[model samples]
Target: MPFESIQGRGATRNAVPARFNLPERLVEGDWLDEVEALDGVSQRRTTITVERPKSILTRNSSPDIGFDRSINPYRGCEHGCIYCFARPTHAYHDLSPGVDFESRLFVKPDAAKLLHAALSRPGYDVAPIALGTNTDPYQPIEGRFRITRSVIELLTETGHPFTITTKSNRVLRDLDLIAPAAHRGLAAVAVSVTSLDPAISRTLEPRAPAGLKRIEAIRRLNDAGVPTLLAVAPIIPQITDHELERIVAAGAEAGARVAFYLPVRLPHEVAPLFRAWLDDHYPDRAAKVMATIQSMRGGKDNDPNFFTRMQGHGPWADLLRTRFAAATRKADLGTGRLKLRRDLFRAPEGRQMRLL
Candidate 1:
């Protein structure tokens, strides 16, 4: 009945109170009036488990998305960004999108093997496979698992092209692999810097790398020849939207080659979670913010329309777009999309040490 809350976490409340396929409304709240909270309420600890999926690449047909194939080495994210569009996804596992989404992670340690097999398949098309599309591949768990690194190694060995999106400075750890790949026209990186303000960023995305750190990450990536791009995502209408020009200029100063922004998307369980967050952090502007979001979403919390979903269609959306365009223009930040080479792809051959 109340917001999903786990004291030290970013999400103020558990948006998905009940597990998927098991609605809480099915049972009366009075029946379980004595139900108490689970453990780790104040301080959540990370739990990593392995998942060996049958396939590694997930293909999508979304018109707004540039890439079709994506690789998610993990099922849940640890960054704990309250407004993460991927939060609702944790519900499929019958888990809370709030605390569980960040603390309980599902890793794919065998991702590299599966990817190698899939790539070796006959007639398999070669394209730039995106990583961290669903959940970040370089979350803190990565330090122990290194699955993302394995994926990169495999792609590099096979001469396949790929791109990665992350908010962590951890990408610098793999500069060795990424730089050479970039030189070979096989890799690019997108660094997500949500807000420049540390205080806002702390509440907006508690576990993600800070805005200045991420800007430095962009700098290091570009300096290492990785062709870094800045992603100022989920431009919350009244909250972080005002920082559009400042963010763009900051990215350009860090040597980012291109920059982009996306208006906040509240889909499925994310709406309630974000609403709870707004109430907790920006109580005064919560109603006004939601009002603007609804206006942009056609009087709803979300709009799943094809083109409208990416950038809503309305006066507010138009103004946001115009602002983004102006900011990018002023910063000289638009260089078009950097296309990775498909021609360089090479599948392994047998007897070449059995392609080992």
Candidate 2:
């Protein structure tokens, strides 16, 4: 298969990862051959697989990240972001991390029920549960599944503090539930805006909402008393680096109280997928971009060190930090933490409690 940009998808090719030792899927002549003759090439459609897990809470002890536990309502985001670090997880299902990670999705319909069980457990501890930690909770399928909404309703009923991170404006649909929780300081939101340029955004994250719409979402979320932050994540060097100050300024103007950024990190399978994306979109400067990224990563594709992983090293990394700091100051957006209150948590009612 040749490398060509799909109409609405991000990955150029569905290369099977070598680490998994999975055999590549080949096209054999059959009924599909007749269909291909009628219609040149087949278009891949989104497929959803239902998953029912016994537990919903994911606990992580990474020293670099802020939260200790989180919830993901869905797997394999349809937003199709070329640089998504979560793509490698699809390999666990014997699926290609490239296109399969985008088109083949999984939804946990039992998320709310599992969450209720966990919260109702004896001696259950309470901490802020982050949403959209691994994959987006508000991807397009969310409109129909409404699993995220169900989880939020349960969290709100129990007064559990939580935070949401997403690139979609669909979150506003749940303003009725989130606004009240935010008023009690139990909820916060961070909207990730990759770039303000429509063309750049379209090619980079083909299915995510436009950047301007996300900025508007921040404005509305803040207007509803929700502590919304601007997340300029995976700031691509040379490509989106120039928009650092501008993006910060835009976020501040939209009433975001604080803003944060992470330099592009390509770990595991993301590196090659990203390379393919660069070849398709930014061929002119792909080499220059990779060179600068390597310099920040100690002349490698990625740096996995704790502190340095989130914040890169070298002069190029230093320049980004300096530029980000100045831009935040100029835009009056704080780089400080937006904490959510955990004291308001109350365990969900168990069978005995409900009977009582």
Top candidate when judged by TM-score against the true structure: 2
Encode model 1's per-residue lDDT on 260-326: one tens digit a residue: 7888889988889899899999999999999999989999999988889988979999998888888
Q: Report the C-alpha lDDT of model 2 over 1-356, residue by residue, as the tens digit.
A: 32222578887767778898977653222325334444366666677899988899999998989899999999899999998999999988888788889888999999999999999888888889999988999899999999999999999999999999999999999999999999999999999999999999888898999999999999999999999999999799988988888889999999999999999999888999899889988999999999999999999988888989998999999999999999999998898778888788888886667553
**All models, RMSD in angstroms:** 4.2, 2.4
Residue pairs that clash (backbone atoms under 3 angstroms), model 1: 4-13, 4-14, 5-13
- Candidate 2: TM-score? 0.95
Report residue 329 deviation for candidate 2 (angstroms).
0.6
Per-prediction TM-score, please? 0.91, 0.95
List ranges where model 1 is wrong by over 4 Å: 1-5, 15-19, 23-42, 349-356
Please name the candidate that would achieve the greatest lDDT relative to the true structure. 2
Number of backbone collisions per candidate, in order? 3, 0
